[model samples]
Target: MNIGILSDIHIDREHPEPNRVIEGLVNVIEQRGVAIMIIAGDIANDYERTLHTLHLIEELTEIRCLFVPGNHDIWNEKHPDKTSWEIYEALKAFSGNLVNGPVALPNGWTVIGDIGWYDYSFGSSQYPIEQFDQMEIDDRVWQDKIKTDWGKSTIEMHRYFFGKLETQLSAHRSRKIILVTHVLPLSDFTVQRPNRMWRYLNAFLGSKQYGELALKYSVAYSISGHVHDRLQQQCQKTVFICNCLNYASQWIENDDPVSEIARAFKTIEI
Candidate 1:
């Protein structure tokens, strides 16, 4: 089986006619001979559009599509009345969402996923934890600070996901695990810049504990997004992958939507 993986499509950030984005995805999936599509995160900024696009991809390609919610995916910007948790539940309600539970695959390989929150472990040591908590740097606020109201500190949220994911990993410890998350688990996947602004931004990018968990549970593939960088590294038994089809302006290799998506689209044989 070919498992197609990619993250941070950010459809709303690029295509004016959303159908074009959906069509591009379908075309790529077909061309790649993907048996199952696993989107790591950030399909779109709004939950509704995100869900709609996932549905369209599954509908058009006729393949099982699974995904975790990125920070942007659960944003309440368009629907201010809904809390981030509400948006989360809404996205998880979809049958294809991996957030619901682990999906068992053939030959003892199982996949588990979640929108793991950042724990400020990725931040620069120069900044205090207090500063990371502020969720602002250089007078610019991290968008999650504005768009999401989880009603909990970032640490609390990270702990919640950590515990939940640990339980899932423990249950399937004997199987070949493929762990997916919206946030980067390893610093190797983070921005390589040593500048202050990036360091501050890096604080919210991800957590080292996730990488720790992958090793603890002996995960075969630790896949994630939100860093907007395409990086892959092998540490111990796990292969960390971040294949983000970032903002259109950030695209350097390709200009066409289908080509961009195709270029970032990665596959693993199961």
Candidate 2:
């Protein structure tokens, strides 16, 4: 079965709503006979935007759209107000299939993945953070919170994320499996944007550790998005497609003109 993958639309409340792209996307999916549409992450600029965009996405098509969250989804500066779990819950409520692990799809295919966070660096491997860019840790005390928080603590969170993946994968080993994420697993597709900060974020968001794990477990394909520039690459046997916005829109006022950006979404056979 064919699946159309997209990400980082970053639709804000301005200019073109997702309506235009959603309509075009629906037409393309129908024309291509794709069975599913996977929106990896960054479907909107924020939480409220995600709610609006998902409603638009659902209205424009009958195809199932599985979603995930990106760094921006939880990058809000407020702690008690914008915790990662809060953002996750928003996503879960908006998209019934916001996959944090493996889920069975139509036909014999199995899907797994997360709109995962950057694997924050530890020790000597860490990226330099500017003094002005201090983390937003508000009144939330780390010591007081434990199992309830997902990204507040150690690699234990990642262990849980990956652990769920391993379990779901183990249950369905024979089907064609597709992994979807918001961040690219390798450096090749990630180097497109000039922002070093975003590049660093992309590098650590989704674990390269899990990328290899998926390959080891016999995944057929892995799709991702985060950096706006479009690209494609491969790791061992798995194909990685960094399919960014199907079309650039005006909400990104400083981005390339809409016509130029829209050209990138031209269809490709799977």
Estimate, for each residue in 1-270, the C-alpha lDDT of model 1 and write its tens digit.
899988898999966556666777888888878998889889888899899888888888999998999999999999999999999999986787888999998889999999999999888998888989899987889999999999999999999999999999999999999999999899877788658788888889989999999999989999999988888999999999988888888988566777777778899998
Per-residue lDDT of 269 in model 2: 34
lDDT (Cα, 0-100) at 244 in candidate 1: 88
The TM-score between candidate 2 and the true structure equals: 0.72
Which segments of model 1 are wrong by more than 4 Å? none
Q: Each model's TM-score?
A: 0.97, 0.72
Q: Which ten residues in a row have the lowest lDDT in candidate 2?
A: 139-148
RMSD (CA, Å), each prediction: 1.1, 5.9
Give the C-alpha lDDT of model 2.
Answer: 0.59
Candidate that scores best on lDDT? 1
The true-structure Cα RMSD of candidate 2 reads 5.9
Q: Give the alpha-carbon lDDT of every model.
A: 0.89, 0.59
- Model 1, residue 64: what's the lDDT? 91
